[model samples]
Target chain A: MEKETHQNIESIIEAGKMNELRKLLIGLSHEELERLQKLLNDPHEFSNEISSLLPYAIRKMVERGEISVDSLLPFVEESMHKSIQKNPQKLADILFPVMGPAIRKAVSEDLKRMIASINASLESGFSFRSLKWRLQAFTSRRSYAEIVMANSYLYHISNVFLIHKDSGILLHEASAPESKALEADLIASMLTAIRDFVQDSFSNAEKGTLDEIQFGSLKILIEQGPYAVLAVVAEGQPPADYRVTLMETIEAIHFNLGLELEKFDGDTEYFKLADKFLQQCLIKQKKEKKQKAPYQLIFLLLLLIAGVGYFVLINYENKANFKRFITELEATPGYHISSSRMSFNKIYLKGLVDPLAEPVEEIMKRFQKIEPGTLQASFEGYLSTEPEILQRRAGLLLSPPEGVEMKIENNRLIISGTAAADWEQNLELKIAAIAGITGFDISGLNKKITDLQWIIPSIERHRFLFDINVVKLDSLQQIQFDSLVQAAVFLDAYNQLYSRNMAIYVRSYTNRNGNVAANERVATARAEGFITLLENAGVKKALLKSQVLFAEDLRETVSLRTVHFSVFDNKPISR
Target chain B: MIKKKIAMLGAFAVGKTSLVQQYVHSIFSDKYQTTIGVKIDQKQITVADQDITLMLWDLYGDDDFMKMKPTYLIGASGYILVADGTRSETIEVALQLQEMAAATTNNAPFLLIINKSDLSETWEIAPETILRMQQKGWIVLLTSAKKNLMVEEAFQKLASLMLNPY
Candidate 1:
């Protein structure tokens, strides 16, 4: 009979007929129903066929509105036992659809009410215990009923309860058992809600208020929450203060819901006050914006008026001062005046001085007085004569121990002197610019003073053997003589009859055609004769001395005159 | 043509921004502006026959924030680790950045910029500190944004380091 009844029950379930299965079960004797219930409850004896029919039966009960907290309790307990006997995972899957939504709804409603009550209590100063009682009463009815109906519903439901508790909703003692089953789940869900709230509050909260709240605990939740919550919170405030606060709140909710409630109260009030403060700030910002507009306009208008006034005053003062300056300038001699405002004054004075016209130095001095502390002027203007300026500019070129002599003759400046330094070329350029000069005759200057010591040594060596002549010529003639004698003396000193191949010639001719005739032949002959005399003095044939001849116009003559000198070794005596 | 990567490293509260501002904008701000993440700026300079574009990255100095992976150090050719001359701890931070750079990448050339030299009496990091850094093979320089001292030279030295790696 039991086999037949089990077969019938299986058939009824297979046909998707829960009503038939109930009818079939009711028709059985009490003993048979007991036996079948036991068999169904025992998963080892209950075939997979029967277990499969269990979900259909429970779904039917739920659809028929017959699966109340009490009504579904037996089936849930039996199913749990059967699931444990067979496969716990399969049982969860089989039970999920029939009980998942209802449990989730019950828990979500319970948590929502709890959160609302907590938030209201915080805002309205309602007693936390009273709010806790009300939330417990509100949540327990559905939570207990669902827990009795489906033990698998405990996971999601527990999470909802804990989240509600974490949100400051107190849990009733009666619902605590179901909540304990959901410890991990509740902590996860609560952490998620807390993290979301803290993050949102942080991002949108009043700027200064967030600093007062602790976010350190929230990171604990981020580390310990469900995968979903962990993932989201990880992105939000990984280890930030908000995450820290969330973590602490979750821990408090788990270990002590009362403390969690207290913290929630504090956080909620803070958020509220921050919101009000932010609104007030927005209003103040609007006021400030409105107030700034007119002040800015007034400021701009004042600036414009000041600018116009300053320009007008500056122009008027400049005009009045220019008239006075023009009157004073007109009194000065050799002054040329030009002013744009003079036409307005109707004072057209020819040859009047231009007030702006002055030496650069005077202009710079006046500018310094007008604008004190101005940088030094870079203008290079001077009022001295060109020659003086040139001399000053050439100051760097003057070598030590050099003197210059200047003479003016026939509107031509003649500079005649010997310069003992190498910089005489540079000095000539300076002295050439003397005033009233048509041209400068600098040819009379000698760059070096002839050294007589060189001649003295040669004279000492050749004094007893030959007559050596030394002649000094005019400046122009001396230059020619120096050039000519330099090569001859160099050759003779090194190659000629050491001391005896020497003769000195000295002659000064008058400046006339007759003088040229008188001296030219002699100068030539003396040069040639010196060479011959060196040969006669037993000097080597290849080493002979010669003479240097200079030509100049004597003081009384307009024609060229000649002077000759014979150098032996370094000296010349009268020949 | 290798782009010059210039990293700006400094302690928690030094005027690295002031130095950068003085160099980049010729301006200074007395207020401290906290940085959260790395900021990037670019400047072009001509050095030794090459037109180098300096890619300057300004990194956060807060030690706690440094926990995040240092993605900013990648591809950096050179570094300018700035420290407050008035704070010795900042020199320590600069040295830390030097070690971080070495550990993260191969030993990249770097310049140790001791900022705020104008406040000489207030300087907590002594000249000996700079000499010590130099002894450790760091290119050290002293600068002052307030007086605009050696600010350009600091940047130029780091830029040159990119071309002639250490």
Candidate 2:
């Protein structure tokens, strides 16, 4: 029963408020309406004060795909324009920090895109400069990027400005962070003036704006829009498509801000987002320049020319230096050059210096700059002034037969050995040319004696010794024995040269410390051992003999306390 | 990563190039060889958790032959002064070259490597010489390119020296 009474009261209240709600609010104060008016004018005030309500509204719009980055760009621009229009002067100052980096970023990205396009065009396909690069890349089997990096020029947009197309007024500007600030208005005005002058002076046939101007390393690129113009100061050779970017930005501005700009006044506040738009067009970059490729090639070419020049110069210098070194060596006497090579960077030498010449130290002092490794030298065994050296040189120069041996004594060379032919006629002339060789002797030399007799005095004088009072050989004595055997074999071979048997004699002696009979016995055993040794070493048994002797009382070393020899020959002539 | 140039200095045939080849290529050659020019090689390694690339310069040995090219020593962060253990004078040469290398790198870290350790019996460099070098506060190592002894360690010590100077 109470629930029915409450339902009737709710219906009567709802029915009364539906008609009275609008009438009751319409009767409020002006301040309340003004408050509502402010809320309507700036939705941010209401939504922001309510916090997450604004986010929720945007989220709902986003969920329904009612908002996008592109669609929001215009709105953001509009809001910034409204705020900037409220106070142009302070707004510009206030926006400086925020817009500075933004403009730089935009300009940097646009420049990079343009540079990439240009570099791609240069490296991807073929053109004049690129053609040359491609041919080199083909020859070197390298990639186009390498060739481009090597030969291509790097470029950068140092500064960019957006100016009112007709007024040449600076609307917005951006520059590299470290770049010095330029008078944007002055540059824009100058460019506008130049453009106007060019159009007036040369546009009689067709109407076109000045597109580019150059000053040494700087270039000004211009792109005209219906409402504004973009003047870019580039430090290097920017890509041609850089103008395409400027034109696109201008077209975007025209599409988004054309209506407001058309009703333009002197106010720049409506273009508050221009800095952001300009920044979106920036770019900067540089490539590695080894400076090596072209320089190395050029250096190689120069090296080729210089190589020949150096060769000629060095040839003359080498000849002169050769002469000087030879002259100095000859003037000092007794220095002989075996080999030498003189070059610009280095000089190589090998020679023999006689003691009769300057001291090696003195010779080396002349070559203070040359290191020891380059100046190779040794002492000379013979000087040309010596008779032995004279004879030797003559012998070598004359090349006498094997049997011909030359001996020099007291300035006279004795060429007494036999020769294949009596080349004495030529020998006299050759020998006379050799200094210190005053005369010749050809007497003792016989040409092929059908019967020959030879004696080896040095081999004969060799002693084959024994240990004290003992005939058994020790290790030291055995060494002498083996040597003796070897000598005997050589002697026998030499004797065979004349078809003769070399006689081997072993005369043994004892020091006076032992009894005469015992010593004689020991001496005899030592001589017999020597005979056995020679026989074993291939000496003819018929050629061996032994003799025992006695020596005065003086103890001798074991090696010298025995029989020595005197070798001679008996001939069986092969001739 | 930082690139530090390290030069090899010593007398002729003292195994400077061999040390570099062993360290870089991980291979040793028994044959003794010499170089006439600066041979540059690169290796990447980590020291104290920092990546570093070593630009090794194998220059020709200096002695009775050519003088060491001072230009090659320029910009070096460190150096390896090698000497033949079989040749005592090579130690003196290494010391002298160290002075030269020092001038170029402003006395950067260096190691005195007495190379040819495989032929210890033939060593003519006196123990006193090595002791003297050590006494002078020089870091000394006995290396054998033939046996690859201490080759990698020598390079690592130098790398660490470059990373943390003093």
Candidate 3:
């Protein structure tokens, strides 16, 4: 039977009849059947089973702390780095959305910080502290901004040096970006020397190393490790926790680089790794204060506005005054403004001006709104034909005497006064040559008559004596009549000298020794004879007129015949 | 680049400071030598395509008035023992300073520089003494601070020895 079963099984296996075999072992070995099932899966079935269990396996591993995120970070970073290196565009596309706001946020933060710093500095710019900082900057050979930040910050580590304890050599150094670079190698050695010097001098320092060294505003904080020392050069007051950070950094260096520090031997190549720790100590914190309102800027702005307003107001007034001055000049009789402009706080004018015109300085003095010496004027001299100028010109040239008055009216020169004869003659000669005078009138003038009036009195005083019955002249009477003729000749000469026509009268007087008719007739005959004699003595016959008059006093006193000569001016010229 | 501290040691008025002045930048004045007993300077030199910076601690001259402090040479990688060629007694002082520096730095590399070689008329050190020192495994060099002769060579040689010590 067994041989028969074996043959069947062999035949079934050879014929690929697994269904019959499954029936054979279905209840006998289920565990073996499950193993066989698992072992007999196809490629697709294997893949599907693994996919189902992968996520759960990973989750379990993560929960149990068997696989850490730290372990996966490098793989992810490496994969991303490779992907970016292969196709940078894809990485850029993925990060674009995040980068835009990130960049904007970072830039805005930096800008806000910068603006705050600028505002703070500007506010302090007017303070006495700012002046002190400026002086310190000059004396310390440092930048003003550096000095300002030095004083403004609450605490700042400018430079951090890692030095070997035994060698006193610089292992590594880190500095703030804004800090000035120093010769760290030299400084490290010098610091070591100073430490050694202190240790040597003070007996109390045997158990302790230098912890702090104060240099004005700068403070050196020294943290000693087993093999190395960390020195931080700081400004302002560092918080107590700052020492903790420095201590931690120094301990980390000693722990991580213990073997290297022990074997330093002036070779700093290995200590470069300590820079990361050293840089962590270059910390800073700014002082906090309320944001003050920008009053100084506002004040400056107001002052600028007030200054500009004052300048503009002054400019406007000056312009108006300049216009008024130009107008005044134009309206004047002898000034003409051709070009006018303002430059350099000055008014420049070019034009023509009559010599007799009102002075420009006098006009300028009237406008106090304009600055002194601000009027630069260039004027060419010109003769003006205006009436007022012409009148002035006539006065200047003629120099009329005190009593004489000259005026210009309707282009005519009118003169009126009592002038000397010579001056009157001069007026007649020069009046026509004056420019702008169409005509002249001197009709109101009078010439003073000097010696002509005296002639009348002298002529009247000459008298001739004649007998009552004798109409003929005797020798003595002829001599007396000659005297009367001479006096008559003097009157005629004066009349000619003065260019006047006057009448010389000859009169006869009779006494009471004769009858009235006979005396009158005799007197008339005597005057007629006297006139004939005066006329014959070179006096004009027309100028010598005869008259007979009875003398009452002489008629009562004595019977004497008298002939008198007198002269009267036809047109008397006042002296 | 490598940095090393080197000391200049000798008797008073031995031209040790003058040698450093010729070969390095003296940021600290000579007054520092009188006050602090040491003036520090630095110089950069190239040897065998390697750049090295030497921190020179010019110690105040050893004399009865101001003896050099061994603390200044605590960390020096090398030293230059200077002697005035015009004074034979400075050679004995230089040898004494060498022993002190050796004790301080554990026999660090050094060079014996006979300075003021240009003052030949006043030179009092015998050449046979220099030969005797050289025979005793001392690297001896003649230098002139005034003429700047062998000043650079002496520093360059010292820097090379410091970088690649025997």
Candidate 4:
């Protein structure tokens, strides 16, 4: 019966019908068939061949929802224990070549569930050793020693993988390496393939205007086992020569593969080593994940905090900008008609004011005083039309006298009317009060009449005196009029005495001498009087300063006969 | 505050150290000291009401450094590539450094510092050559550590460029 069952199983396998094989096993006796089935399933259960099948089956089961990850885990654990008991060595042997595919399949099949399970178990403080044991059971025979060693290798490889993966993803989104490289040739080939693919895609996408394609690749060789390659293609073309040079990269990788494996051994042994490595990786990944979880969470928390901070900062900046706008508006010069309608930070003002007026300094100063930094004003009123109203108001404020007429047109103030002398100041003030007035025309204005000649005469006299003393003289010679008067006092006294004597002589000559007779006597008397005056003034041997000679000297100088002859005829007529 | 990371790269024995020493220490060293890996120093400065931290990296003088490991050039905000004023060959190195920096960082702000300007009589590189290089998108500045000419200015300008980044 066992032979028939074996033959039937062999036929089903030959026909490539696994379902039939399973169905045929049910027909044999339970004890014998169970033994045969266990034997038949042992290779698939413990070997690397099962590595391929397991992923496929798990994927299908997951897709169909026939087996949840929680339900599948126990079976995986049992299989791992059974394989290890059956042949720990064989299970270890299959791991190296198949580790790449196995890991890839595992990740692809149920990345979300695996991540969740790992995270959940990690939170519960389940040790990495426990996780490694589980992974080893799913993939191979679970030996404690193999699992421990495998955990360490996996830790190193996963670290490398994560670092390279981050770099690759940052550089290019679509092409990232799948594994780590044990061989230099694999690294080279992976780099070249990535470079070429990125260059082609970038050139095609950018229409050939790009300069360089930035990308990264992952190449992992399970020494003496299967090779896994991952390439990331960037969106731009690199240099053409670089692409050309990359074609030989695959050949180089192949060469490096030989060198890498030579450092190890045959394929089966290599896979066994890799299997141990995978086990180690699983444990290490679990441990590292547990260790890094807090950090990742912290990083996420920090990012969230930063995001909130940025948002608040942006809001503050916007508010500040709004406040600044309002302040600028308030600082401008204008009548604020809608000041109450706006907030302190968003005040608005409107009114008639000169747009091109001078010294914006005045406007700024006024605005500063009104609201400090909170107010800004701008003039939007019609400067050309409002000058008349402004002028009238200014006239009223200045208290102009009743008759003075003032008008403002186009920023020009016009005053054309007569005003009392007392109203002159008031008129000037009225014109000055008009806003935006560039100039004032008061051509027709007149002042009240008042007498001022009496006052002017004295002022003129003083001015004449001042001019004589100071204006006509050089700066160095100019002196006070009183000083000059004091210095000339004696000369004036002497002149007065001389004038009196001469006047007496003249009167005596006119009275005493009739006609010609009296003239001769008067001349003699004048000469005598001048001499007497000089003598009285303390003069000794005095002579008249004038060119006219005295009477005595004149008689002496002239001959007596000629004088008598002239006097006989003249005296006869005068007497 | 954003810290600007800048690098001083050049060929062997181009007085990069002298320039950095003059600006940082205000002293001139006649002796030549070759750098090994990378040396880092920092300075605080202000521009337009913003405080900025300038992180200056003085790389080694070996020409083969770029070829050996390009990773050292990553994360640079700006670069100052120095060349010897007396040697025209150094200018070639400067050009190569520019290319490498552009390739590494996608054209970050870069300036070319031509050192040893105190020896103008011995200079074989003409101003025209520097101008030509500048026309090709390289900023060239003449400097002399001994004279303290344009050394601080080079750093200030590079820091400003890094801060603005546009």
Candidate 5:
């Protein structure tokens, strides 16, 4: 009974302490008592309870605008990154349905832009406006295309780029038709680097920015945003509202793609949607100008065509003239063309020409196609066989004296009219030398035969009688001697004028009464004495020859012993 | 196509341009070296079946006229530190440029090239020094731009590293 009372006392004290704890917790709210009960139980039960109300609590926080999305953005990006890293193929599979159409649209758009630009360029070619633009380009030292763009448009946005601000990476690019495209990646990075360099050199980058970069007529307008930068490569001056457009574009990009920009890696596939916004910035306005006909181009074309046609006509005329000249040369007997050519509008001819043929210069004078100082000719002299040429040659060679006429008929030379004895003597020999004359006819010529023809025979028939061994001219008739000397001189003169060789021979005959040797000596002396007398009388000694002959007449006749005279021609006579 | 910006950093007259000329164009000129502040060149290479366009920024050597501009290396994906094998002091300048590159490019991938290896007989950099650099987890290659030795291999190696960074 005593031990039971002691135990009861300890239990009572414990109960009293619990009672005191229970009384201390009595003032707590029901939620506090339940939290304390849960704290004393399994830890998983607390998790389960919090999880059940977590969505509601977050909703309340978000609805009340008490939660900062910025604070949660990093976690969401990290989770998505982890998901993609876990299985990249899953994201790729999700995007596969739209990729084909997107790529096709991009390619078709590029092709269309190229075609349109090509058409525009072709249409503007050789136009008056294009010519003016070309002139402006030349004076200003700019490209024709650039000048055309500058003059045709009031302002043109050629290219637009959406670049990541921090990494200097190009996210998207847009351009107008035929805009000069550069390596956007490199340009973006270099642009960023240059901006950074300038900002670092001048002031902090956060305070101010590079608003514009002007080079010639091109202006690189930059609009900065929180995550991306919008750059416009504009030709000509853009209006103030253009900047407003850029600002709005950048703002829209940032607002729409804030989260994506924050988590942007090297993958730009998502930014491709930004092309539409960029394309909107590729704005252009044309300058109003009067439409004028391309008179200058038309005139230039007409001038070119006319010039070419004139050159062709002149060439054809020259060729025809050359052909006619060659025909004329071929037809004429004395002219033979070895070579004929035209160069630099000049005609050159090389041929053989007979001296008797018609002059080539005379033929050239007939055609105005041949210009003076533009004809070069080389010719070799030659004899011709034509009848006309032969007649002219015969006339030139014979050179008949006055009152003498010569003509060629049937390749035969016909002489008609009076001719001197020496002239007639040379006609037959000269006719043989002419190429085309078969023979000569002198039947119609009234031959003078000169007074020498009769005088020479009369002198030859009458010989001077010399004494048997006297060797003297004492018995010679003075009148007859003088007549003989006159006839000899006249014959020598005729021989010299007609290129003839004629001589008078004096023969002495000795009687048989003397010995043969004595007779020969007497005959030689008699002939030499006669020659001396003739030479002293003004007759040429060369015209007289001395000869000796012993008569075989035993009768010793006086006629045979007398000296004799004869005439002989030294040259062979053809007639 | 993936594009990466690479920077060439070195001391003056260290064969950086020569190595680039050899690797990119496979040509060499014996004319005197001309100083240029910066030059940009591009070449396409294939690594692991992926095409990559490398934009090479050949910066002026670190010297008094124009010290290395950190701004030039802002978007560089990798860099190559070139030093003349005949000059030991150039290694220090290359190291200094490497530090600047690291600071500006967030410690991007890089390679150390001891150039003019054809003149190894006249090298002032000892083998021990190169061994030290190698031991410090740096990829070092000996190249002779004059001989076209290891130029292609060096660029390809850097491209691969850039494509698949550690």
Candidate 6:
């Protein structure tokens, strides 16, 4: 090491090893260098090269959180301050372009917040105020939604902005008449810088972006996209769904002005139609706060007055009607009010409501729609639940028949009262209709309404032997005519006593010795001859009814060929 | 089958209606009627073994009184600019109309048709004026609706140019 330590001795390039060193180095080839130099000289190509990585660089910067838009906001404010102090006349011209957009941004946010509030109110249950608004909205000719906005929405958008995403330059603007005075360019730059700074700083750990900023009551809402961002400032929270509208605007700008936007050099004259997109943001302002406010309040107040009036009236009507129902129920017979109280829609009557007294359930039903399964009838009665026993007992105790006596003995009804006639006559019709009526004995009744009084209710058959189908009566048969006369008199007495029209039914049967028509004629003639004899014996023609009955056995058997006599009342009397 | 829309653009009362009537119906009407809104009519013809349906949008002529709407020329494959040879100003109007049509049709193939050639004695348009347009690479034709001369050929020329752009 101490023999030759020449520090300046160059062994690599001194021996014509420059080519070897150049080959080992990482320098570009000559042709490639020339091309690169040319590319560097061209400004368009240089910018184009950087532009390719602009999006990625911007994203990386945003993710790092090392930069923020606040850093550049001072520059914007300084520039405007300088203009105001140094070049006052140029201030208007400098600020003219930014005014519309600046105000529009604020208004857009205000309008958005109002919309969000309205939606929130609707999503929640209706308060008194909200319900009033809903009713007003229904009555108005306008749509319910429009009326709701008119009532609940207090903020509006006076202007809107469309700014370039990369350069933060105002592309186009829309504004109401009142927002014509503002500096939109400076605001756009400040907003962009703020967005950038916020995105780059504290937001580095995550991909989340700043969505809002607050200053006093004024607020700003930021909506982000891949290529652009929209900032809105307002006094309240913006509508959550306004993002869809803003997104659509961004999409349209991307589609229609995409090519232009990429190569844009701060010229916005071509984007004249940007107002069309921003007009959506410029919702008509709520006219004079006091004026619109009073009108809505008055409407709500009037609606509330009417609603309260209706509710009071209905409550009064229901109370009055319920009182009347209670009074009527107490007055009704068979209803005993041991304890009666009305709890809401139910009427609890603990009194003894006699089941037999006009039927408690039926009494409740008489009043339509008043009682629907609300009647609870508990009656004090005999141990038996049978309807017959209940009916009999109730009838005897409530409205006992006049001058009538009843005894249910041996499971057979025994009655001595004169009104027992009425009860006995209804035995086959109504009293037996009860479920548990075993049987009845009217033999002890005084009036004898149950007496077998109609012609003894028996068929009195009188047979006469006819010789060779001749209908003439022989001497022996003529001897029986007195009995026939006596039978007619007896039937007449039965009719008078029973208070009915009892007729003598004489049915004559003919032998089957000839044609049916001829035999019927023969039998009819014989019946006529017998009637003449009965008429001479004092029987009325209306009381005598005759008919010819045909039978083949009558032709062979002498006993079978006969005239049958039976007495019957045309109208049987129950009394 | 292919649908090719064509426009009839011209000056006010410049025989545009007459030319369309002649080309579409092959019939002549002596009535000098002014068209109002665009009158749309269609006709089918065979060209190069393909059926071509021609939707003829006869746009109302452009004038100081009634300027035609250019939206009517949208989706047009070709157009015919009709001018009355008797009026030289109508030729200028035809050029203005051609500009409007070209804007909407995306410069579709077109023909400049000078109508009313049958009234040659009363002609006001100069021959040099038409020659200058021809030199500027314009497809020009002289048609007479009254005589029914070269009217169909004028429309066919534009149609063929559109179908076979060269």
Over A1-575, each residue of candidate 6 has an lDDT whose tens digit, in order, gives 43244433465335446545555685656567678898899999989998999989867886685544544578889998987899787988888899899999999999999997787767534677667766776776445555544554465444466766654555676765443344665455456555555554556477887677777545666666554556655534456676677778777666666776665543466777656766776654343335445888899999999999987886677566556766776676545566665555566666655444556555557666456665444445323433445446535542435655666654445555554243445544444544445665555554433233432543365556555455667788776766666656666655566676767777777656658788778788777767776787788787888877666654444343577676665886455
Cα deviation in Å at residue A39, candidate 6? Answer: 46
Candidate 4's displacement at residue A141, Å, is: 57
Better of 1 and 6 by TM-score: 6
DockQ of candidates 1 onward, in order? 0.00, 0.00, 0.28, 0.01, 0.11, 0.00
- Second chain alone, TM-score for each candidate: 0.91, 0.95, 0.92, 0.92, 0.96, 0.95
Write candidate 1's Cα lDDT for B1-166 as tens digits: 3344566888866776677778777898778887666555556677788776565666667465554233456445677888888888888777767787876646777888888888888989866877877898878888988899999888887777767763
Poorest stretch of ten by lDDT in candidate 4 chain A: A561-570
Candidate 5 regions exceeding 4 Å error are A1-126, A134-145, A203-207, A259-265, A290-575, B32-37
Candidate 1 clash figure, as a count: 30
Residue pairs with backbone atoms closer than 3 Å in model 5 (clashes): none
What is the alpha-carbon interface RMSD for each candidate?
A: 22.7, 26.0, 1.8, 17.6, 3.0, 22.2
lDDT assessment of candidate 6: 0.66
Please give the ranking of all candidate structures by TM-score, highest first, separated by commas: 3, 5, 2, 6, 4, 1
What alpha-carbon RMSD in Å does predicted model 3 have with respect to the real structure? 17.8
Tens-digit lDDT track of model 1 for A337-363: 443343332333333322223433343
Among these predicted structures, which one has the highest TM-score?
Answer: 3
- Local accuracy of candidate 2 as per-residue lDDT tens digits, B1-166: 3546678888988888899998989888778667866566667787888777676777788967588756566546788999999988898888788888888767888999998899978989877877888999999999988788999899999999987886
lDDT of 1: 0.50
- Give me the runs in candidate 6 sitting further than 4 Å from their true place: A1-575
Instruction: Compose the digit string of candidate 4's lDDT tens values, residues A220-325.
Output: 3211112322222222222334333222332333333434333321112222222222222221233344354588889999999999999778667646654554
Write the number of the candidate with greater TM-score, choosing between 2 and 4. 2
